[model samples]
Structure formats: structure tokens, C-alpha cells
Target: MKITILGTGGGARAHTAKLVELGHEVFVGTRDPEATLARTAPDIMGNAPYKEWLADRPAVTLMPFGAAAAAADELVINGIDGHNAVAALSAIGDSLAGKTLIDYAVPYIYQHESEHPWPTPWGVMPKLDPCDTDSLGERIQRALPGTRVVKSFVTQEQTTVVDPKAIGAGDHTMFVAGDHDDAKLQACELLRSYGWTDILDLGPLVCARGMEMYAHMHSAIGFGLNQGFGGHFGIKVVR
Candidate 1:
């Protein structure tokens, strides 16, 4: 399986590494590959440099967005921020046709503000645009009509996404939703490959409304724990 993942952030690093371990041919997409590799500072989560993340996994290739998507065989993982998702996919154009695009992006921190006074326990939540009614995944699906869009991995931290055991998260439901049956099945298999035990299939792309909106609940719990990103474990659906 040839997989192209877009983003240089934590999620991208985690996804790329795990996919590589699964023996998938992996390519990482970034706005500027050279600049990304040249980065020396820690990321927002205080993770090591991007180039450092690659040192252990040299098999993973880094390239600009266009080429990475063009090279993808099985799926394209959107690990970039949701605010720029459409633009990034738009840049890829026809290369995404007939492909399963697994979207893991959420509203970027700054874009969380809107007229809505969406309240959370910690504070008054910023209005997340395209949420409640639509979602980042839906936007990508609409923009790239030829692609099979699956919304997934948006609620988990990068650490939790790859290693659920990192925070002792066990037998938890990882919610995934999309309109395409085959693509959704492929995503479920991908999750199982990475050791996800409980997967909640939430139906169509429109169901992404809940997935993306869960960020508030995630934040409240993380803050309550007072452990920051490492302490943040996502939703555990109990039946």
C-alpha cells in the first residue's frame, strides 16, 4: 500500500511512522519540504524537530503536497490543519480522483472564533466554522468530488492515534464516518492494523459534525486532568 500523508505536524509524524512500520510505501506532504526539514525548534506540543522524527524512519519520503498526492496508491491522509485542508487538496487537483482520502484535520486554533458563543466547561468556546452543520471532511469531499472521503482520527491526540496504550486508553471507540462503503471499510482495516479495538462507524460524512465538535469535550477533560497533551485521552463510548 502506497500512502501519502499531508502535514508536518504531530499527527502527520505519528501516522507516517505507523504506516511505515506496517510496510506501506509512505510519502509525507508539506508546504515546503526543505523548510520543514530545516526546522530545529520543538513543535506546539513540544515534540522534537520534524527532521528528527524522520531520523528513525528514513524510509518515509517527504515532498511537496502535489507530488505526494500524485504518488499515493491506496490512500491519502489529510493530517494538515482543517482550515487549510481545502486549499491543500485543491492544490492536489485530479491526483486524488478515485482515491480514499482519510481526513484527520480539525479546526486550527485561531480559526475557532466565530459569532457563535459556543460554550465549554473550561471557557467560552470559539465558534468553529463549518461545524454543527458541516465539517472539514465534508468540505474536502465536496471540493474533490472524485475522491472517497472518510473522516477519522480527528478526536485523538497524535500519540493516542498511533498508540492507544500511551495513555492507557483501552477498548475505546474510534469514531469514523463517511459515505463510501469500500473506503470506510479500508479505514476500519487501517484502524485495526494499528491496534484500535473498538471502532464506531457513524454513518455518512455529515456525521463528522459530532466528531469535530467533540474537540470541546476533549479539551474539557484534558484541562481537568491538568496533564496537557500527554494526559489527553479521547472519548470512550460505553454501550
Candidate 2:
């Protein structure tokens, strides 16, 4: 499968690593190509020598955001922030008319610094914006009338996203909510390749409202649990 990851954050890198591990062709698209490349250069050099040594690697592509969406095959995961989701979508919304976009944004309207502790248990789990009554992923879905938008993987830490071995520490579940059965299955296959053995399909896209809220709660768990950096959650099903 040809995949395009449209962000430069850790989540983007995690997806890239997992997809490449699955032997699929992956293209990374970012807004700030040069800056993202600089930040990832050292890590790529140390961890992904093959990708780094690829003859056609672009480190970052310079296309407009809309162009990036047009270039993808069947999947699009929004690894960017909730605040930027609409703008990013606007850039590529038209081109993504008939594709399945796997949305992964938590619309936290507020955040904190070390000095200013948040009232909530998780600083990352701030109150969302007024307009985010439903959820940004849902909003993205509503905005793109034709695109099949599925929400998933918004309830965990960045470090645990691609490493399934780390799931033994009580962090390995990835939550998904979408309207399309086929799109969810395709995403499940991608998740399987990323070492995610367990997934919770929380029904349709409306369920994303609950999933996003839970992800907000996880922000504080990381700090309080002392899991510090690599914490995540997964379900162990018994037959």
C-alpha cells in the first residue's frame, strides 16, 4: 500500500516507522519541510538507516498541503493538532474527496507549562474549544462530505504508538471509531503491521467524541503514573 503521513511530529515518525516495517511504500509530507528534516535527521541516521539511505528519499516534500492529499492512495491520518486540522484539511480537502481519511486529532483548546499546573489530572487533557462540542475528527468528517473519515489512535502517548513490546507495561490499546466497515478493516491491517495486536472499535464516528475525551484523560495519567515517556494501553481479549 502506498501511504502518506502528513505531519512532522513524533506521531508522524511513528506511523512512518510502522508502515515501513510492514514493507509498504511510505511518503512523508510536512508543512515545514526543512525544519522537520533537520529534527529527524539524527534519529533517522541512528534508527532507520535503510530509509535514510534510500536513493529517492525526499526527507520532506515541498508540495502544498492539498497536493499532498491528492498524492496519497487510500489512507490519510491527521497527525497534526486539532487547532490546525481544518486549515490542513482545507488545503487538501477538495483532493481528498473520495478517500478514507483516518483522523487522529485531540482538540484541546488549552495546555500548560511546568510552572502552571492544570486543574485537570492530565495537563494535556485540557477543555476543548467551544466549537469542538462534538470532536475535531467528527468536524473533519462533517466538513469533508464525500471523504470517509475514521477516527483512531488518539488515546495514548507518542512513545508507545509503534512499539507493541512496550504494551506489557499496561499501555497498548488503540481506539477507533468510524462509519465504514471496510475503511476500519484497512486501518486494522495497518495497525497490525505496527505491532498493535488489540484494537477497540467504538462503533461509528460519533463514538469519536468519547474516544477523544479519553485521550485527554491519558495526558495526566502519563505524568501521575510515572510512566514518564513510554506509556500506552491495549486490550487483551480472551476467547
Candidate 3:
């Protein structure tokens, strides 16, 4: 499978590495290849810089956003920032048509630093932008008419996403939702390949709300455990 992942952050690197490890051809899509290669900021989950991550995976090709999508043969994974997704993907134009788009973007608004602290309980919770109205998945689906948009892994951090067992979390179920059945099936295979054992098929792309909103609750739980932005835990549901 020829996979193109959009973004050069932790999520993108994690997905790209796992897919490549699974024997799939993967390319990374970024706004600017030069800047992407020079990026030194830590990812949302506090992983090392993109340049550092890329150093380990020399086999992966990094290209401009549109070129990556245009080169995709099997899947296109949305690993970019939620707010930038529509514009970035829109720039790709019709290149995404007929591809299974696994969207993991989350549109969120952080509270002002003055309004909140940086520690647990109060200051640690994250706020989402489109709650009860829309989701990144629905917006992307609308942006690209013919693309099959499926949302998954919005609830997990990069490590948990690529390796569900990494956090010692047991049976923490991964949820996937999309309007197209075949697309979801293909995504499920990819998820399974990345070592996700327990997955739930939540129907329809609109259900992305629940998955996206899980971000807030997931953070709360993380902070509660003193794992603020640490990406060291996951949730497992019983029955």
C-alpha cells in the first residue's frame, strides 16, 4: 500500500513509521519541506522535533502537501493541525478524490494563559471549537466531495495511536467512524496493523463528535493522573 500522511508532527511520524514498518510505501506531506525538515518544536505529546524524528526514518519521502496526496495510491491520513486541515487539504484540490481519508485532526481552542494555569485539575483541560455542531471529519468531508472520510485515533496520542500497548493500558478500545463502509474496513486493517487490538466501529462520520470530544475528557483523566500533556495513558471501556 502506498500511503501519504499529511503533517510532520508526532502523529504523522508515528503513522509513517508504523506503516513503513508494515512494508507499505509512505510519504510525508508538509506545508514546506524545508521548514518541515527544520522544525524543532516538540509535538503535542511532547515527542522530539520533526527533524529528530525524521533522522531515524531515512526511507520515508517528504514532499509538499499536494504532491504527497497526488502520489497516494491507497490511503491518505490526516495528521495535521485541525484548524489548518481544511485550507491545507483544499490546496490539494481534487487529488484526494476516491481515496480513503483517515482523519485524526481535532479542532480545539486553548484557554488564555491568564485565564488558566499550566498544572493539573483546573488549568490542564483543553477546549474544543466545534462541539455539538460539527467536527474536523465532517468539515473535511464537505471540503472534498468525493473523498471517503473516516475519523479515528482522535482520542489517543501518537504513541497510543501507533502502539496501543505502549502505555500498559489494557483493552482500551479504539473507535472509528465514517460514512463509507469499505473505507472504515480499510482503516480498521491499518489500525490493526499498528497493534490496536480492541477497536469499535462507531457508525457515520457525524459520530466524530463523540470521538473528538473525547479529547477533553481524555485530558482531564490525564491531568488527574499527573500526566498533563504527557501522553502516557489511555482509556479502556468495560462491556
Candidate 4:
């Protein structure tokens, strides 16, 4: 599969690396080409960081955000953080048309705030913003209009996303909701590629409201229970 991830943060980079590991042709979208090269050149040359980062992994091609969007074939996973998601999609909406977009977004972590525990006590937990009564996924779907949007991986924290093994301690659910059948199936396959076996598909994109609420509950538990322990959840079905 030809996958292009439209973000360059650590989580976005991690997704790119994992997909590359699966032998898929991968491309990373970034704002500045020169800066990305300059930052990675030292490590790639000294065979220290970038070399080690991609040592056993497949080759990841870096391109401008526009080109990456244009080159995507099977899927285009949006990995930008909360605040930037809408704008990022807007910037590349044309290329995203008719493509199956695997959206991984959450209303997590407020801007201009220090990193704190999950479900912070300062009244930060609103599953969907007031304007987005339908949820972020639905908003993006509306923004794209023609794109097939499936919301996945929003229920899990960054820690669990990079390491699914952390979900071993409990039986929790990673809720998925999308209107398209083929898109959901493809997303399920991608989730399994990341070692996530247990998935609960909650019908169409509107179910994303429930999924986001579930994230709120999970975050509350993490903040209220164990501050030292990171937030993690996985599903167990007995049927």
C-alpha cells in the first residue's frame, strides 16, 4: 500500500516508521523541506540517529505536504495534533478527495497549557467541542465532503499507540466509527498492522460521539487513579 502521513511530529513520525517497517511505500509531509533535511542530515550521516531510526525499517520518502497528499494510493492517515487537524485537512482537501482518510484525532490536550495528567481536574474534558456537536471526525468529514473518513486510534493515548503491549493489563475498547464499509475494513487492517487485535466498530461516523465520550471516561480514570501510570485501554470480547 502507498501510505502518506500528513504530519511531522513524533507521533506522525512513529506512524510513518511503523508503516515503513511493514514494507509499504511511505512518505512524510512536512512544512519545510530544508529544515527537515538539515535536522536529519547530521544523524543520518554520522549513522547515529536517523540511520538508527531507519536502520531495520523500510525507506521513508520525505516530500512537501502537497506532494505527499497527491501520491497517496490506498490510504492517507492524518496524524497532525488536535489544533492543527482542521487546518491541515483544509490545506490538502483537494488531494484528499475520493481517498480513504484514516483520521486519528482527539480533542485532547489544550493549547498553551502545560503537559499534565489525563482528564485534568481543571475541567478540560469535553469529548467534542461545543461547535463540533457531531465530533471532530464528523467535522473533518464535512470539511472534506467527498472523502471517505473513518475515525480510528482516537481512543488510545500516545503511549499505547507506539506500544500496544501496554494495553495487556486490562480489557478495554478502542472504538471505531465510520460511514464507509470498505474504509472501515481497510482501517481495521491498518490497526492490526500496528498490533491492535481488539477493535469495536460502533457503526457510522456519528458514533464517533460515543467513542469520544469513551475517551473522556478513560482519561478520567487515568487522571483520577494513577498519576504515575500512563493511560491505556484495550478490548476483550467473550462471544
**What stretches of model 4 exceed 4 Å from their correct place?**
36-58, 108-132, 169-172, 225-230, 233-239
lDDT comparison, 1 vs 2, better candidate: 1
**lDDT by residue for model 1 over 1-239, one digit each (tens)?**
99999888877888888888889999998999999899999986577998888898889899999899889996998987877889889878788899999997876456255576655444555446676777888888889999999998888887688877655556576888999999999999999888898899999899988888887677767767876433466567888
Task: At residue 97, give the lDDT of candidate 1.
Answer: 91
For 32-95, candidate 2 gives per-residue lDDT tens digits of 5555435534452144322343334444343445667777788877777777887778667788
Q: Estimate each model's TM-score.
A: 0.89, 0.77, 0.89, 0.77
Go through the candidates in order and give each one's C-alpha lDDT.
0.83, 0.68, 0.84, 0.71
Decoy 1 TM-score against native: 0.89
lDDT (tens digit, per residue) of candidate 4 on 128-221: 4523356778888888898899987776764466557666743445556899999999888887777776678889998877666566666666
Error of 1 at 99 (Å): 0.6
Prediction 4 global C-alpha lDDT: 0.71
Off by over 4 Å in 3: 39-47, 111-126, 168-170
Angstrom error of the Cα, residue 197, model 4: value is 2.6
- Regions more than 4 Å wrong, model 1: 109-127, 167-169
- Tens digits of per-residue lDDT for model 3, 1-239: 88999997777877898888899889889889997677677765577877888788888999999899989996999988887888888878688989999999888655645355545544544466778888888989999988999999898887678888776644688899999999999999988888888889989999999999888777777767877564577777678
